[model samples]
Target: MKPVSELLKKRAAAVRSVAPESTVFDALHLLAEYDVGALVVMQDGKLQGIFSERDYTRKIALQGRDSRHTTVREVMTPSVLVVRPDSDVRECMSLMSQRKIRHLPVVDGDRVTGMISIRDLMDDIIADDEMTIAQLQSYIYG
Candidate 1:
């Protein structure tokens, strides 16, 4: 089975992120621009928090807070669950499943390495299974 590092290596080299001081509104804009569900919050090249659509909905919208006035530090998940670049894909999947989170920030120490979504995992798993089935069929038929 391929590792999470392999998936990250196969995809783009880095994660999408914003500064912790950035407003929730700005973070929302960045998420829309990147077409992603979450953005890793970084400050001084160190991971700070993670902001997601759920945060905006649950924290800002539910509280009737002004997104433009609130910073990511105010609305983001401060205790973010992060995965290492060397972690296995199964480990990542388990984390996401157990936490009920769709997005996970991949970190290499203090640096943001990449971001992953549940969709990415499902796609990779499906592709791998298909490849395995095809290989088995070819061997049996040949």
Candidate 2:
């Protein structure tokens, strides 16, 4: 697997983020618009936290809080686990698996660079596996 930076490079879209002060409704809107499960919470261009569908489900919907009146900072996962640009795909997988999280923010210091999801890792892994299989088949057949 390649470094996180490489994956970031291959990603065609910019990192989707929302402000911590934004309403949960606003965050949810962005999530839906982008078709992503999670978003990096940025405050003044710095990584502040992360808001995910799980956060909305667990903190807002379960608690009966109205998203329009609730702020993302109030319910976001503030003590965020992040990966560096140089981090290995396996390292990210380990952290995500152990934490039972689907998303991880890629940061350089406090600056949010990108976000990675479980689907991204799975796609990369599957591509790598397919390439390896193709190589083995060519070697055997030739």
Candidate 3:
């Protein structure tokens, strides 16, 4: 399995983020703009929490809280499960599966590098398998 650092390199150049004090409405807009399911909640270059669609739906929509007024800090998922850049991709997948979560923030010491979804891991695994199959076919037939 590749390290999380390799996956990070393949990700977008910017890691979209918002401050804890940002309104849920604004966070939602950022999510839409970035075409992502979640945004990292950061303040002073540190990861505070993660604000996601799940957080919005369960905490604001279901709870009848106004997104325009309510702060992301009110609904954001805290104590986020983070993985170091050197962490194995498969291990991160297992962690997300067992925890029933979709996103994992890649951290190196005190800095947040990037985030990865289960979809990213699955795509990487599938690509690796396809390459192996191609190599096997070449050896067998050529």
TM-score winner among the candidates?
Answer: 3
Each candidate: how many clashes?
Answer: 0, 0, 0
Candidate 2: pairs in clash: none
TM-score of each: 0.93, 0.95, 0.96
Worst 10 residues of 1 by lDDT: 1-10
Q: Where's the lowest-lDDT run of ten residues in candidate 3?
A: 7-16
C-alpha lDDT score of every prediction, in listed order? 0.88, 0.91, 0.92
lDDT of 2 at 113: 82
The alpha-carbon lDDT assigned to residue 49 of candidate 1 equals 86
Q: What residue runs in model 1 are displaced by over 4 Å at the alpha carbon?
A: none
lDDT of 2 by residue, 1-142 (tens): 5888888889865889999999999999999999999999888788888999999999999999999999999999999889998999978888889999999999887677889998898888888899999999999998
Sorted by lDDT, highest first, which candidate order results? 3, 2, 1
| Candidate 2 local distance difference test against the native | 0.91
Residue 118 of model 3, lDDT score: 88
